[model samples]
Target chain A: MKTVYVCSNTVTGIYSAIYDAWKARKGEEECSVALRGAVETELFCEYVEVEETVHKAQAVEALICRHLGREAYWDIYHAVLAADTGKGDAILGAMLAAKTIPDSRRIMEHLSHPKVEKVFELSRSVIGEAHFLKGAVRFRELAGGVLYARISPKAQVLTCLAPHFADRLPLENWMIYDRVHRMFVIHEAKKRWILVQDEFLDPERLPDLTEEEKEYTKLWKGFVHAVSVESRENLKLQRQHLPLRFRPDMVEYM
Target chain B: MSSSESMTTYTYEGIPQYMPQGAGGLRPSMFQKLNILADAAKYDVACTSSGTARSNDGTGMGSCERSGICHSYSADGRCISLLKILFTNECIYDCKYCINRRSNDVIRTSFTPDEVCTLTIEFYRRNYIEGLFLSSGILRSPDYTMELIYAAIYKLRKEYNFQGYIHVKAIPGASKELIQKVGFLADRMSVNLELPTAESLKLLAPHKTRKNILTPMRLVQNRMAENKQELALYRNAPGFVPAGQSTQMIIGATPETDFQIMQVAQSLYQRFELKRVFYSAFIHVNEDSLLPARTDEGPPLLREHRLYQADWLLRYYHFRAEELLSEENPNFNVLFDPKCNWALKHLGQFPVEINRADYKMLLRVPGLGYKSAVRIVKARRVGTLDFSDLKKIGVVLKRAMYFITCNGKMLYPTKLEEDYIARNLLSAGEKLPGEVVNMGYHQLSLFDDVGFSGKMQQYM
Candidate 1:
């Protein structure tokens, strides 16, 4: 019988499904995996919903750490954080390949392997977006005296970007809200930053910029207007470097 | 006056605005001033922010990372919008090649010290830029311009308390005391060499002599060296141009050969310890009979790209300029890159055993960059690295295959003949920039050379 295992949309939940699937060993072609919110059911397939059990997830984690080493685990973990709907199944397929193929710990480097290639591609996108946002994220001084910045990244990158800002502006009170994910990485002056989830942060309810903020924004807009060389103006190249989606939040573009 | 007096933003029209004082007695809007100055300053190509590691103190609002952050790239695939504007576009000299020459009918304006600091700090706070790249035309004299630059940087550091990277141009004939003062506050300083040769400099820029440019460069170099010694003794001795100095030479404007340019660059690196030598593909702005006529192909961008590639080979690949090109071979081959051309010419260096060659030897091979060379050394230690392992380590086997051997075995029994490898390299041409390829000037490749496709499929 062709069986489809569905699980929650998270790393731990996916790991639990992988654990159950491995224990069954119903052959690679017969068993399939999908995330909870995703429509991935095949016709005539027996569907099984896997509960996210801590023990089951830990069991899969231990198996991966033992066989593929720590680096492979990180590779799988980062790739899972990608916005791809098929990420859960991609990791499951890669894990199964690791079990079957000898010396498959180097699978991430193998572009020929479909599942491995998918994971590698997704990991690069997630990492690349995070790196770009490090330079792109703009901070505005809010009325309450804390610095505030908002980003609507496609990937779930708040966790990836938090540590960098924490180390950078340790003594300042700041908050970087991931508007798409409805999560915030808040850092108090001289204190460690913490991640908070609140889906109710309305776009209309953002605080007004301080007067000092207004002057700086005016200055920045003036500078940006002045800096670009009119003779060699390449709007196409500028679009490639800083995409249009990033324009709405950027003060200069506004 | 206290430094704070010069630190305040230059106020105009009853509000604090950093607009330049007009030499032409014209009060242009801030926007207009920016447009004119930026247009004049655009020819300078050094928009780099690398090689500084300044962290923001608890009080400051910004930090400078050592690796350099490229906040944005321009239309020409160059990094831009680092507030790369001139303090003024007013000039004292009429260099034939310069857009900001006194003889040109362009608007003349100047920025006060306060205006520059305000712009730098504000833009930096918004993360729109990494830092500032300030260059200016000589307003009244070189000393006057250099003093204004010093005051601007001093206010930016002391008054604004901004600890970000700042790269300033040291005016060729600026006073030593003034240049030293600015050097302490600025991260990097550059003196434009203008042209490769003294003859070319005199021919184009009649007013500015070669000696005037080199004198300030040598002073900055010696002071930077002396500062290094003091830094070892005193922890906070204040670094002198902590990011080091660089210079730019205008290509295609003058009649200097690629060999002459490379030799000059090599000497600058060896003698003055310059951080970089920028080669700007000269875009014809002013209509001058003395300058090279604008050809159908526009700028010599391909030639500039080739020189930069050769520069990298000199810096990292341990290849000398003499080995790449001699008097007879003055120009680089347009068909292949410097490394591939070198390898093809000296076929005796072929089939370097990948597992046996040292790091420097591996670097000499085409397609093996510094990162890949290091990875090869690290990976081979654990086990024997076969062709599959080399592919996994991210080596570009297309070029490297002809040069490297796996366990003393060639990937395919490749011949060491120059024509054979050259044909393969041509057939497997990497994607070129549209600007470089669209000119229809490059020699057409013989991709349909018989049996090469069959040979390539055998490896696959």
Candidate 2:
């Protein structure tokens, strides 16, 4: 006499649905899982469609906190949200699976669901960039009272990376935009963060370095070049560790 | 080799790394000199993590990553965070072993106090590094170099108001007062043995002796202890080397046996309470004929990596150097990791049930890292961890297979053969031909067996 609906996409939407399911756990309300863009129903069933709501989303956050403490909540939430697939089903499974808090290494294992796999990939990509940024990121000062850089990354990593800079440069204002992803994270340090989605802002092109910037850059480049050991020029190993793509953004390379 | 370019010639004679040599004056191009010197000093492997301490307060520069990663790479390829560099490449001491020996016609340079401070701050501010890891070749007398260093660190701290991790190297023969002063400012300090033994020092580096290196090392360790004792009840006490002191020894340069290296490492850890002992695979950077025939016998990297792995065991796993290496078996087994190798030789210690083995016991099993060891301990707190759970705990059972059991079930079913398991773990055989690996454990008799060399055992 009752109905079960089960196809939905988007981890947030999926979590939103499970949150709805928990609310109606004692209800005789018919259920259906539908994809974000799709709706299908059988003849015998009365379809109940649930849209994602912040209030409903809050319950999922609570469930995540309860099921997988604060840190694990983040691990699961981000990993699920990162997946490019049946985010809803993955959430459904992960919520069920998060019953026991796994150790640090096992936490990564839960990230393998097709829906949230992209998050693991994205997070790993960001981590990879942070490491590369360690050796290569170059900054040049602008006369207009700003420091800027041009970096081309292979993933949607700009958002994940803003905090490290913000923590390091608490007094300075800076903008790191993924020109490719078309969104940039701007930090005012001791203030709120802003992510710009404005279409009018052009990001790909930037101004050149000024004289002061050029001077500092030359010193760094000379240091890197001159310090490079003639006895051991393992360019193969150097390039393997630091890819050529990151060179343009690094002060030592520039 | 040319007669003038005698293979045994060190850079500069009469000056020791222990004795710094001059009335240190302000040098303008300190930054360039530091890069030249530190680049040369990079061959010294003592820069471990200066640990995470950020200066990102409402002002200028730096945040440290929790990974404690710094300039150097780990065996599994983890980068160290510290912006490690030397103060000057111009050393007066000519240790035949060193690249910056007065003999090599390499670039000579030194970073001034201001230059050192500025580079550390700039690199840190750009989020390019965590903090400074400054070591220096003694530009002047050890006292003079100490003066320049103290000024540089003082400026970085007081003038610059930098609260970042600062790891400074201690110049031997510098007064204990100087050592005490530098230790209070820096998070960590170091003294390089360069060579392991006193006899070896006499032969290879005439300007230095074991006494010169060990004296300062002991003084620093003593000062660190005295400060730690005095500060026991105080909050944020001015302790010396909060991260503790570390030292480096060039591997393969001296004829000292692996036994000798392990012995010195053991004592350093035991006596000085050192945090680390880095083994630099001697790169044939300078052709010092006093060195062994620059054969394929380059600084054994695999050996260095193994030494580090063993050092980790000694520091963390409660393994003593004597237990790990001794007169009878002075070298680590090249076929298996130190832990697994140990377990193989001491099979009576194996077949430890994962669910019941104590933390110390679990650590002795091959293939179990700190994580797995901790996992084994923590998991047992809940319910018993079976063989399957052991796998989930990330224990590499290949080497550990002979050692641990889960719910009384072996991950692999077999009566363990010592040689079989040892050979099993040495899977990377002949990948590079004509090499006796770092352990000095290789015996041609072990290699002569045709079919027995079918494959090394693989303990997960």
Quick one: best TM-score, which candidate? 1
**lDDT of all predictions, in order shown?**
0.78, 0.63
All DockQ scores:
0.32, 0.26
TM-score: model 1, chain A: 0.89
Using DockQ as the measure, which candidate wins?
Answer: 1
Which portions of model 2 miss their true places by more than 4 Å? A1-59, A66-68, A77-92, A97-140, A149-160, A179-181, A189-192, A197-201, A221-254, B1-35, B70-80, B226-239, B423-460
Candidate 1, A127-234: lDDT as tens digits: 888877877788898888778888888887888877766655656688888888788898998777888875557757888889988877775566555555554566
Q: Single out the weakest 10-residue window by summed lDDT for candidate 1 chain B.
A: B447-456
Interface RMSD of 1: 3.2
Residue pairs with colliding backbones in model 1 are B20-B110
Runs in model 1 deviating more than 4 A are A1-81, A84-125, A139-148, A160-174, A187-192, A207-254, B1-26, B432-436, B439-460
lDDT of 2 at B265: 93
* lDDT tens per residue, model 2, B25-127: 3333544554565467567555455444544666655555544543323222334356667776677788887777787887655565667788877655554
Query: Model 1 over residues B222-300: C-alpha lDDT tens digits?
Result: 9999999999999989999999999999987876678888999999999999999999887777899999776555666
